[model samples]
Target: MEYFKKILRFAKPYRVYALLNILSNIFYALFATLAMISLFPMLAVLFKQTEPVFEKPIWNGISMGKEYLMEYLNYFVTQKSESGSPGDTLFFMVAIVITAFFLKNLFGYLAMYFITFLRNGVLKDLRNELYVKTVELPISYYSEKRKGDTIARITSDVLEIQHSFLSILELVVREPLTILFTIIAMLSISAKLTLFVFLFLPISGFLISLIGKSLKRKSDKVQKEQGYFLSILEETLGGLRVIKAFNAESRFSNTFKKSTKRFYNFSNSLLNRQNLASPTSEFFGIAAIGVILWYGGQMVLVEKTLKPELFITYMGLAYQILTPAKAISKASYGVKKGNAAAERVLEILETENPIAEIPNPIEKNTFESGIALEDISFKYGEEYVLKNFNLNVPKGGTVALVGQSGSGKSTIANLVTRFYDVNEGTIKIDDVDIKNLKKESLRGLMGLVTQDSILFNDSVKNNIGLGKKDATLEEIIEAAKIANAHDFITALPEGYDTNIGDSGNKLSGGQKQRLSIARAVLKNPPIMILDEATSALDTESERLVQDALEKMMRNRTSIVIAHRLSTIQNADTIVVLQKGEIIEQGSHTELISKKGAYQKLVEMQSMG
Candidate 1:
């Protein structure tokens, strides 16, 4: 119920539809009672009970208001003479019953009609908000979550809320109101009989509540299992080549089968428990009906205190409570199931972004002499990855970082982009602290080409144009020419329009890296960061990518995180790192003359 309140804010825009639904439900409830009461007149006439001597009058005293109403209604049933045929009165009685039923169904349809807008409206806004949150959240957030779980939350969880919980809102309002109207009519006939009917209700309610107590726990398990298998399916599709090459189909299949087996047992238990509500409630209702028959029969036959026709009408009203009662029981179970999904959705929406920008951030218009890191330190966890690190890249010059794995070469690139802020000291661009600058303005000055070329499932032109949305086709081709990717791209069947097919799988690794460089070239930022851009390629591909990379870096301040020594020999400055500290720094000539860490690394790689 608390989760429902949180989700209700999405419904604010559709209040008009919600109000109309409530109003229509009121009419549906009233008509449902009228339909049941219509049975009374037929029961009286068929029992030969509505004769002039014995038609039960609605009022006892001769008050003008009550007397006038009673006479007005009796005018049509002029007590068929005792000698007249029963068919004379029975025809009119049947007409009243049919008319009552027709009006009930008509109002019920109207109730559903008004509720449709509210259900779909909430669904539309909920999905929109979830998508916005996913895009707005910082990149670091994705490092800790499973993509398929997030996907399940957006698609399947929202659909559950729509079909299962939202559909019950129509019944929640209408069923309770229908019960209220029917109970009031029963009291009008005889308060004592109505009182007897309600005595067993609380006991029945307690039993139904027991079944739903564990439904949420079971439902949460089922949804989690759904995400687990979905994640495996998503990964398998993306890495089918790796899986087939390693012959690991049995391993993935076993993991998938285990998750599905848990889902099977959980769904069976959850649905079976929910299914018990209908029959359990019905059985209790019938038991109550049997008791009422014995007691009410004594009142009519032995005590001669109640009329048979009125008593029959009272019994009909008592039975009417069962339908709505069963519905209420079912809705209670639905709430339990929906609560789990609602909590999952709210968890994402309510998550506080840890890396929000400052209220009033600075803006650096341009990079001047250089970017500098002064005693900067950082850690992805407890152990610092970059401890007291320092470097500088003068504008229009190249500085390269060479280090073994886990020595923080990539962390420096991440810090410059502000993907993760430094923990210990300040980083400045042209003497201005980067922390003071607006994030977008800081990122606008730079372009990045990483080891993995992150391309979308779109056309070659669209993929490159991501760096600059309104870039013309001619501009895109120019950038690709600089990247040395123009030949292969033009050779494709659709040229620039051909789809890349998920992370550019249609292209070779070297071709994809070239395309990534073309995107950066299209952006044409004043500063560039190339982190292992050519390390993953063969010698031939590396030479080609390196040549294109050098062309793009011609007039830009470039920071290259390199693994191969051959790539950085001509860098304006090369820094060698070990154990989160700088061990040597100089040009290739100066570092080799020092005969220290840089010289040792060059010696080892050259020998290998």
Candidate 2:
């Protein structure tokens, strides 16, 4: 219920709809009880049991409230029978009963009608917030998490919360109120019989609660298995090329099958338990009715203390409690199931992003002097990827970072972009600490083109203009020309308006990289970081992409992290890193003259 309360907070915005639902439910419950009670007067009229009365009954106080209501109804029946025939009295009684039932169904529909808006409204807001938080979180947050689990939270888990939340409102306001009104009517008919009914109800309620106790644990397994299989499915799609290339299709298929089989078992157990709720509750309801029949029989037939029509009406009211009781029991299990999903959904929504902005952050829009990495130490976990590292990149100059795979070339680009903050030191952009700068304003100063040319399934024009929202077609084409991507784009079907399929798979490696470069160029930021932007292409593709990079790098403060030494030979300064430390720094020619680590690397590459 702690989690239930937290999930309900999302429904706060839909209070008006919630209020309307509750208000409609109140009327529905009242009418539902009255519908059963209306049968009492009709039964009296049917059996010709009402004694004629000439005058109306007097109003009485609370202690005799039940007797007063009975007398008043009898007086009204007596007057109707006196003025007209017995058949006429019966017709009016049947009409009153019909009207009561009609109002009951009408308000019931209205309750659900208003609740629909509240339920769907909460779902929309929760999904929107989860997506926003997912995007705002640091890249490091995803490193240890599966994309599919997050996807499950945003999609299925939130859906669970929406359903569970609605069930809660029903349990709290509708079903319980219906049961309450029904019980009150039963008490009015026979207080002693009502007291007898309570004895069996508590026992049935306790047994129902016991059955639902393990439901949350089973539901957790079901939701977790769903996330697991979804992860496998997501991975299979993403790495289909690799799976096929390695001839491991059967392995992935078997893995997915195993997850689905688990899901099958978990769902069976969960739904079977949920299925038990209805029958179990109904059985207990019938059992209580049996007990009521035994006890109330003595009052009606043997004791000569109760009226036949009132006893029948009391039984009708007694049966009315069963429906809402069964509903509450069923929804209690749903709450358990929903609570499991709520925990998963709230876990993501309530996560604190480590890369949060400061209260008084400096909104730096311009990059003038340089980027400084002073005494910086950073790590993804325990072992530092960069330790006490330092560098200075001047304005309008090209600086290349070259290292082996684990030596931290890409780490430099990540730090400079503020994707991950340094552990022990301050990274200053134009002499202002990045920690003090607003994240949006800091990232706005730079453009990044990574090894993976990430592009959405969008048009070529939209992809190029992604960074600059208001960029005109002329600006887009001009940027594409500078990145050497204009000719191929013009040759594509529909030209700039052509749809690039998922991750831009419709284009070649070189074409994709050039589009990414064109995207950076369109942004026209002061600082450009190219982290192995041409590393994954064929020889021809690499050459075409490198030419685009060279053109775009002009008059920009550039940080080029590359492995192909030939590309960075003309860099204004070449910084060579190994094991998270810089062992050499100079122009390529000077590094060649050092006869050190950089020289040895160049010699080996030449041999290759």
Best by TM-score: 2
What TM-score, computed on C-alpha atoms, does each candidate reach?
Answer: 0.90, 0.97
Off by over 4 Å in 2: none
| Number of residue pairs clashing in candidate 2, backbone atoms closer than 3 angstroms, sequence gap of 3 or more or interchain | 0
Query: How well is each residue in 266-297 modelled by candidate 1, as lDDT tens digits?
Result: 99999899899899999998988887898789
Candidate 2, residue 149: Cα displacement in angstroms equals: 0.8
Which stretch of 10 consecutive residues in model 2 shows the poorest summed lDDT?
48-57
- TM-score for candidate 2, please give it: 0.97
Provide the RMSD of all predictions against the true structure, rounded to 1 decimal: 3.4, 1.6
